[model samples]
Target: LAIAHQYVTQGGLDYAREILESALGPRKAKEILEKVQQTIRTTGFNLLENVDPKQIVNFIQKEHPQTIALLLAHMEPKNAAPIVSALPQELQVDVATRIATMESISPETLDQVEEVLVSQIKSLFGGDVSEIGGVKAVAEMLNSVDRGAEKNILGNLERENPELATEIKNLMFVFEDVLLLDDRSMQRVLKEIDTKDLSMALKGASEELQEKFFRNMSSRAAEMIREDMEFMGPIRLKDVEEVQQRIVDVIRRLEEDGEIIISGRGGDEDIVV
Candidate 1:
């Protein structure tokens, strides 16, 4: 008895649970088995460390709300938001509510959730994947969606769960995120933008962002844009958004190619090489 107790304690609760399962029967040991397996998968290996967010979306769609919520909780919000937005309307609120309110889930429950994903992931490709949602993940996802879908998801989230909404918004980068770029990167982006598109994009921009753009340009160019904006009268919101999205696309491409760094998306570090 002493030796068994020592082995259980030394091996950890998971190992102990596996031993007990043999006597408890499969039905009674199901929950314990789940915890043991989940711990092994997550801690023993990076099974889903950097898997695409879309893959996560596929998995969560078929899961129970509680299970989905648990998985999302573990993921970055950026990755989770798109999944939430893409969900069938009826499930959105329920799953989101669970995310906002979920707390202190047992290892057994988490194991059960991870088990479902692990099995599906194994069947799909038979290898380790990346972790899911985070603030950055949600931000990146929002950056890709249409404005209307973005707005609706955030609106519903704000109503159903204000706290999570605020957190996600802070993480996201919209047209206004341009202001966050350092001067050099900002200038690089400016060089690629057409005057007309810039004018249209700024039609609905806040004075602060406009000032940021002006501050980054030659005085003459600033004066010219100011003049253009003043006369650009009554532009459609959709047009402004389209041009803004275009500018955002340019910035994203530049960032992807290592041409420029956008602050707060984790690229602020000084690379020695």
Candidate 2:
């Protein structure tokens, strides 16, 4: 056990697990193996996370979307988003769609992706076959990407697979994410959105989010929107959601156009002067 633990600490998790199984029996080995496996996975994630995204982009650019999706599914969203954004635009959509619809990746497929990474990245992938790449994965990755890449990918995805696109979009930055925008960005977004749409959208929002928008506006304008929302009274959930989506679309468009910056969500960190 001491020798195996040494091997594990040195990143020889598979070898250590095998040694443990042989010496300690499967039942006892399993407990140790599980811990070893978790360590291996964390090591694998950190190894990839530490790599330059451009190196990864150049290495995998020519690979099939399914291959790209499978590899990215193993990475943390922050690490994966830039690679997706750097991919050729068409591949971006294809990979995003594949990731949204993907359920599980076979061990063989994982090994193949690992082989590609090992050749170019000098990194190892160590983990069991597991569920990965569903709508949430795609959403999280997209959330971390620039609005332009995110919009282009989702736009193409909408035409190719509407239902999957809607599902992924639903999981992504919702109306509530507006609260994440800085005051300057919030004011810029408000300029693009109609007051009625904003009122309707805020109807379903939390008080905090409503106040976020209100504080960014003039006192008169903020009070007017509040009055508009109250007069509208008891709007349908579906209607509120629709208007919220429209407002969210406007925010996405403005960001894509470089009119505003949404910081701390991922992607490039902007230093505002």
> After aligning candidate 2 to the native by TM-score, how far in Å is the CA of 206 from where it should be?
4.6
Worst 10 residues of 1 by lDDT: 123-132
Q: Write the per-residue lDDT of candidate 1 for residues 1-273, one digit (tens) a residue.
A: 343344355796666666667777666566554444454445422434466657767766887887766665565455555566677766765665565555555545545555556666762211122333344555555555444455666678888778888766655657989987898998999999999899888889999999888888999998998899888779888888879988888887787577887665532344454
The runs of at least 3 residues in candidate 1 whose Cα sits more than 4 Å from the true structure, single-residue gaps closed, are 1-69, 73-137, 140-172, 267-270
Please list the C-alpha lDDT of all candidates, in the order they appear: 0.66, 0.80
Superposed on all Cα atoms, the candidates' RMSDs to the truth, in angstroms, are 13.9, 5.2
| Model 1 score (lDDT) | 0.66
lDDT, candidate 2, residue 257?
76
The TM-score of candidate 1 is 0.44
Q: Across residues 1-273, which tens digit of lDDT does each residue of candidate 2 receive?
A: 456567788767677777777889989887776665555654674677787899889878877878778778878987899898899898898888888788856556666666666766667764554687789999999888876788898888889888988888777868888877888898888888888898998999999999999999999999999999999979899999999889888887787677777666554555456
Which candidate number would show the highest lDDT if scored against the true structure? Answer: 2
Q: Scored by Cα lDDT, where does model 2 land? A: 0.80
Candidate 2 residue spans exceeding 4 A from truth: 1-32, 115-120, 146-148, 182-207, 217-246, 253-273
Please report, as a residue range, the 10-residue window in candidate 2 with the lowest summed lDDT. 263-272
